[model samples]
Target chain A: MKKDLKFYRTLFISTFSLSAFTFGGGYVIVPLMRKKFVEKLKWIDEEEMINLIAISQSSPGAIAVNTSILVGYKLAGIPGALISTLGTVLPPLIILTAISFVYNQFKDNAVVNAALKGMQAGIAAVIIDVVYDLAAGIIKKKRAVSAIIMLGAFIAAFWLDINVAFIILASGAIGAAMVIYRERKRRRV
Target chain B: MIYLKLFLSFFQVGLFSIGGGYAALPLIQNQVVEINGWLTMKEFSDLITIAEMTPGPIAINSASFVGNRIGGIAGSLAATFGCVLPSFIIVLTLAYLYQRYRKLTVVQGVLEGLRPAVVALIASAGLSILTLALWGEKGISDIGSINLIAVALVALSLFVLRKWRPNPIFVILGTGAAGILIYLNI
Candidate 1:
């Protein structure tokens, strides 16, 4: 698809704004991205958007960053990926740079102390919500193996104090082994 | 030396946090708090708050926050880049390879297993933080000092999220304001 500079500019601006204004992390960006990429820009169809989300979720990294790169690559190849990533990082970098300077100054102040202390509970709750949200999605799918893995992983992580990296690696191995064994058994039957 | 350590720490964090943003939290805590001795447990919890209020992934925000604390903006850049480099390369390769072989069972199986594990990782991370929030690192020493207000706030936030599920930004901001008013007396 031959395109002009406007394509790149829009990709940059839209991604920049999305990364800037959107909060609450990766999952939050999906629908907003669809609205822009699918409905507004028509750069990608709905299925492609869904595919990007699936890929982003399955792969490592933040979903927002991953999708932005894919969308950028789709529009203009490697350079598009680079530009969109620049857009993605720019706002957060600037915002964080500014906050870093001030955080040291006001972190120990009275109001800041109370605010952070108060927010601590809320932060805990939010993390709980993340846990629930993810579990809900998996449970709704109703896969017994997935459910068992979730429970087992919780034990490994929380109780056993296993390293998270190893838990993931082990889970993936079990999951693959289960799939393979089941398939082989079915073929025999 | 600080910069190199920062890069390596975050690099390890980025490479292994397989599921999503929140999945990275435990690793972040380990590398920053346990290994590096950069921040206290309390300060680490506060960093989560700062990251929560910031406008990006918790991993990136904390990388920025931790780096700045250690070595200023230059450190921030090094840590941030280190945090993202693994993701950048992995995703690009996956995007390319996935398009070619979307049906590989190994690929599908790994993704399948990772989801539930990701859920577990997140829950584990949350409970630890909740423990810190409510009890403050001393179950035996300071059992009497549990913060009831924070507990109430946690209940309220969870209820709101479950029922309304509104924008998380508002929920966080609301708690901040409520936290100020409620915690000011304490």
Candidate 2:
């Protein structure tokens, strides 16, 4: 029991600290997590790390949290998952709470406004970087159909102001249809 | 009743917010602004700005802010948990199944199709944020030409920096300085 508590405590602290300071969300955190979990701690192998990213992205929730939960669970089971998730989430929660409390007071503050404006620009760039990486992966796979789906989705959302969920659902339907079509074709052949 | 609704709503977000936290934005905006009437559109916009600037996932930060707005500390906890639980359960289950079906071509084909859509979703998110930040009446009315310039410079610098590989922190700070300069000049 004591050992379990110690493990949970450690897991929680590590996850909380990592999540607290991580910036730019899922893509940025991936490499950092690879370093920490695979290289430093040797907690999981490279293949597992890749699988974790895949599963986390495909599954619901925040990718960072999902990754932590999987790693934690892998290391120490359900308790570890709980502890790590709490750890990963707690710091950001506390920090954002403090920010929220002070936001109104600083709403019109000049320096704060400037800093945010700058960060906004950086965020746009980071997002572009993410898109570029994804595009490269898709291109490498020679998945032109998927590329078209992505383009259509972007145009739909950007030009028409369609909701994202609808796009995702539509894309999923298309994917399912393609699978069924391919299977039928193969059977006929 | 209100708290229960809050919990259930965010729980739904947590459950289906696949592809990442940014993907959750439109749903979150709809729920908080249109459906729930918890926040004004402006407030929701501002919350997104705050979420972007902060650490952790945007969805979690938004949940905390929205939660706090709705019901203080307890509300925040409820919303955060609600946002997280669904994904956790779903991912865990998927992770287990993934091991067995890892090599199936049909499964691969589906994932291949999903990847591009995810990219498109993210690009749309970027465009939406850009429109909100740079093209609003308030944005134009207040800052006018200077804001447009800032947006252009930022976008251009981002493009260049992608090729050159400068530290992202530096780029952020530089754009911040640009904002301050624009403000002072105005």
Candidate 3:
């Protein structure tokens, strides 16, 4: 028991630290996580890591949080999950709180204003990068149905100001139906 | 009671908000702004702008900011945790069964299909952000043609810089300067 606890604690800290410093979310963290959990810790293999990313992306919540929980649980079960979640969340929570407090104090400072403006522009770039990468991945896979779904969703939300939840649910249902239809067709054949 | 409600609402947001942090925005807006009256649409939009400008995931930052605005520090903590809890629980559960179930052909096919959907989900998120950035209240409609030009220029510059692999900080600084220059001229 003591040995297990020690191992979990170490895993928690390492995972938390990596999450804390990661600049971009999701894909950017993939290689880093692969190194720590797969290469260094030997906690999970490469295939498991890929599987985790897939599951994490499909599930609700941040990918980083999902990844941590999955990895932590894989290593040490429920207790591992708790520790990993805390580790991933704590750093950003602390840092953001500090920044928010300071921001409130200096809300009107010109220099700070300038810096924020610059940061906003950078953020736009980051978001663009995220979109570009995701688009490239989908295009590479040549999934026309998925691409159509994405394009449709984007048009709906962008042009009509439709609620996003409805779009996602509708797309998910459509995807599931397509799968079922494919299965039935195969059986008939 | 309000704190609990806040917690539960954010929990729902976290529960269904797949893809990534940005994907949660429209849902967050719907729940917190339209349904609950916790924040006005304008405030929600501003919060998104602030979230984008800040580091960390947009959802968590929005949670903290919105929570702080609605119910102070305690509210902030509650909302933040709520947003994170679902993914935390679900991933853990899935991880346990992952080893045994990962190889099933059905499971593989489903995941393979889900990938494109996930991509679509993310692309929708990006489009939503673009809409907000370009056409929300302070958007091209109100800000005039110059702002539209600014948006186009920024978008173009971003695409070029991304291809060139220049340091992102420079692009950020440059955009800020442009915003300031435009604001000053106006």
Poorest lDDT segment (10 consecutive residues) of candidate 3 chain A:
A114-123
Model 1 lDDT, residue B98, Cα: 80
| Best prediction by lDDT | 1
What is the overall TM-score of model 1 with all chains considered together? 0.91
Error of 1 at A86 (Å): 1.2
Model-by-model DockQ, in order: 0.67, 0.53, 0.41
Q: Considering only N, C-alpha and C atoms within 3 Å, which residue pairs clash in candidate 3? A: none
What TM-score would every model get versus the actual structure?
0.91, 0.84, 0.80
Deviation of model 3 at A189, angstroms: 3.3
lDDT of 3 by residue, A61-112 (tens): 8887788778777677778878888887776666655555665566476655
The deviation in Å at residue B55 for candidate 2 is: 2.6
lDDT by residue for model 1 over A92-179, one digit each (tens)? 7677767878978898899888877777788888889878878999999989999999999999877887767788789999889988
Leading candidate by DockQ = 1
Better of 1 and 3 by lDDT: 1
- For model 1, the superposed segments whose C-alpha errors exceed 4 Å read A1-7, A136-144, B137-142
Residue range A1-189, candidate 2, lDDT tens digits = 244666677667777778878876777776788888899867789998888888888787889989988888788778778888898888778877777778778868887776566556555665566677777887787766787898897787667766556776788778877887888999999
Q: What is the alpha-carbon lDDT of model 3 when measured against the actual structure? A: 0.67
CAPRI-style grade of the A/B interface in model 3: acceptable
Encode model 3's per-residue lDDT on B1-186: one tens digit a residue: 978987888887887677776667667876786678887544554455555444456677767777776777788899889989878777666665665676655544554445555555555544444545455434445545334644764576577677887655456556667656654455
lDDT of 2 by residue, B47-78 (tens): 76667656788788877887877777888888
